[model samples]
Target: MHGPVSTAWSLVALCAATGAYCLLRMRSGVEEQRRAAGGEALMGFGMAVMAVPAAVYAPPRWAWPVYAAVFGAAALRALWSARAGAHHLHHAVGAAAMVYMSVAMAAAPTAHHAHGAPGVPPVTGALLVYFMGYVLLSGARLVPAAVPAAGTGSGGARARWGDRPELARACRLSMGIGMVAMLLAM
Candidate 1:
């Protein structure tokens, strides 16, 4: 029988779907924005793919390097772009978290446990933390909706942001649940 942890993996998959859908829905006239949207969508897909092996077995030592390269590139891009003050805060933090997790995963050895090792595998725990941070930043995208003034007939503002807040919320919840599962697995 499937354990509770498996359910969490399902949540992660759901989050990936929602995140990808949201990114696709956003309008991106600028080249950078377009790239960001595409990258975010790819991250969502990657997260889903990662969940499969994560759900089944502890991530192998090699997997960490792969994840590191992928997320490290993204973090560098986001940080470099941020120099121009073009990227959003969420993107910056998200990339930073990814970099941190990648490093942590890469540093994790895949052998006998250490004396002070976390209950969950180091790489798995790091992955969980990274994803949890992503979920938080992703959820932050919805904060603007909390202001009633912003909601007041500001069709233009709403249009500028693309998909509705409900959609963003759905994505956030999905990521949150997914992270929870990842943490449980760890």
Candidate 2:
């Protein structure tokens, strides 16, 4: 494979591995952790599908509609569960982005072209920017904050990173950087 295609495949592998790890973490015995892991697994798997190089496998014309329909359903589910939390909102946005990308790919003049090129259309560029920003911000939020011991309660209950696990944070950062690379490759 060429450089961009190879890189995209590498990112897809990383996403798959992250998804596996998240799935394993589901047994961590913490309800919040399980929920977070479940979400991460879904995100990772979805990203892997999105990151696949066109050279390897570009979805057929009919497949685009199917992909859009699947993601549309996911978006609808997310919308229905909007009251769940910010993660659900993010999932909804992700599903919508997938649907948009699938439709755009179907409509592209050279839909069968290789995955990464030097010039991406303005709309794809905008979407890349949005995803890059979201990934970076979300990763940053996963970082553990430092708190003084004095700030702890009388029982020494220290602040933590909450439901965000270290591996999950690393995965987010990896995907964020991967998105940047993909954007540059375009």
The candidate maximizing lDDT is 2
Error of 1 at 96 (Å): 3.4
Which stretches of model 2 miss by more than 4 angstroms? 1-3, 28-36, 109-125, 147-164, 176-186
- Alpha-carbon local distance difference test for all models: 0.58, 0.69
Q: Write one digit per residue (lDDT tens) for candidate 1, span 91-179.
A: 55555555555555565454325567447666556657766776676677656755465447756444445444456455545655554
Residue-level lDDT of model 2, residues 1-186, one tens digit each, is: 124777888878987887777787777758767766676677677667767887888766787788788888888877776787766776677667667766765766475575765576786677688778887787777766975466566576532433345666776566556545544554
- In model 2, residue pairs whose N, Cα or C atoms come closer than 3 Å (at least 3 residues apart or on different chains), thus clashing, are 117-186
